[model samples]
Target: MHRLAPLVFPAAGTRHTATVIFAHGLGDSGHGWAAFVENWRRRQRLDEVKFVLPHAPEIPITVNMGYKMPGWYDIAALGLSAGQLRENEDEAGLLESREYFQKLVQQEIDSGISADRIVLGGYSQGGAVALFTGLTSLVKLAGIVGMSTYLPLSLKLESTYIPKPASANVNAQTPIIMCHGTADPVLPYQLASMSRDHLVKLGYPVEWKEYAGMPHTVLPEELDDVEDFLRKVLPPSADGKTEL
Candidate 1:
């Protein structure tokens, strides 16, 4: 697999072992979540955790009338005005994205980090892709953390996702944490719930949380939840499993 240039944020003391690759939302750079990441870095004392943020390549967005933007895939229409905005299904683009991030995961594994110690996470559009890729991952990741995100390729997941023999039944393994705002205007709450339910019906380990009155953004409480999740998934050290 080729290399992907990602914004690297090492542990509090330059320690490296655990890995977390976080993608940014549409039209936003990988650094878009810098401040949010800083909050977690300061609050958590994970000296061995390494954070990777990958910037999305610029692409034409259908909803924006083919205007170029940094998006994982083209959005056909927002359907907001007519309540019919829908993501443009780009099979090639989505598959390309999955390959790119999959390399990042393999990179960490090749560098001595165990597959189970690597976490995949993102926000909004990034979160959606993370779910799409992480769920279909051949290697079992520590967990998947998606905020304001929904499952993509719902119809194709079962058939397209190539799983390892050990992961033939992914429903019971590979825990997932999905958070959304009940009052979200961009990605409606119902859609998020539907995505969660879809996974639940498929028997995936999915945890859905709703934030009251929140919009298409993250809240402090939501950040807290993410931090809590990270702590629970990654061990503090190779031999130490205390606070993370």
Candidate 2:
């Protein structure tokens, strides 16, 4: 259960005001998205925001025929239908990964980053973890971002798994943006929309973005939207100690 060191990009500015911890999809490492951080740096944006990209540990993937790969959790099955995707979910794996993400967030807070100034985000399987963690976080966060992903452990939301009490949920009012593609071949469009609908039913406000003719991948336009979200949640602070 050892984790690989995360790929961290220090804030370009002298002041470290905010943080975004983004996770990669299954079979991908933190290095897979290094260019994203570099791209924002090239534009001189989010210069005061530190980016932390954590690498998921290698584990046996059932969908890949037990092949070892970088994954946040084990997928028992993969299908074009959303129902098929939720079958035999690895709950233990999901919780373990959630704990790991929580630890990373705590490290940032310990380093003086306000809890409300930190965002938890990811893609695909990583996104699932982010959603789960953000929903169940003890501390309030600035926002949550999920790209081309669906909610995990959806069935347990009303159960003891998620603590049904309103006071127990710190992220109930946190901003969440979920982006999905209509033509996704891996995770169907229905999954994203249904997940959003379910969250709305549970009284969570979600900002959903749909892309036309896009697949299970990130587009430049998607990045632009994400950049805007980051700016909205993590605005520039005159002093690095600004608390939201």
Task: Please provide TM-scores, in order, for all candidate models, with all chains considered together.
Answer: 0.89, 0.95
Model 2, 102-189: lDDT tens digits are 9999999998899999999999999999999998888999999999999998988657456557787878889999999999988888
Regions of candidate 1 where Cα sits further than 4 Å from its true position: 1-4, 79-87, 162-172, 238-244
| TM-score, predicted candidate 1 vs. hidden true structure | 0.89
Model 2 global lDDT (CA atoms, 0 to 1): 0.89
Residue 78 local lDDT, model 1: 51
Report the lDDT tens digits of candidate 1 across residue range 55-140.
Answer: 89888888778998888877775524212433346767778888888999999888788888899999988998899888888777
Residue 36, candidate 2: C-alpha displacement in angstroms: 1.1
lDDT of each: 0.80, 0.89
What TM value does model 2 have? 0.95
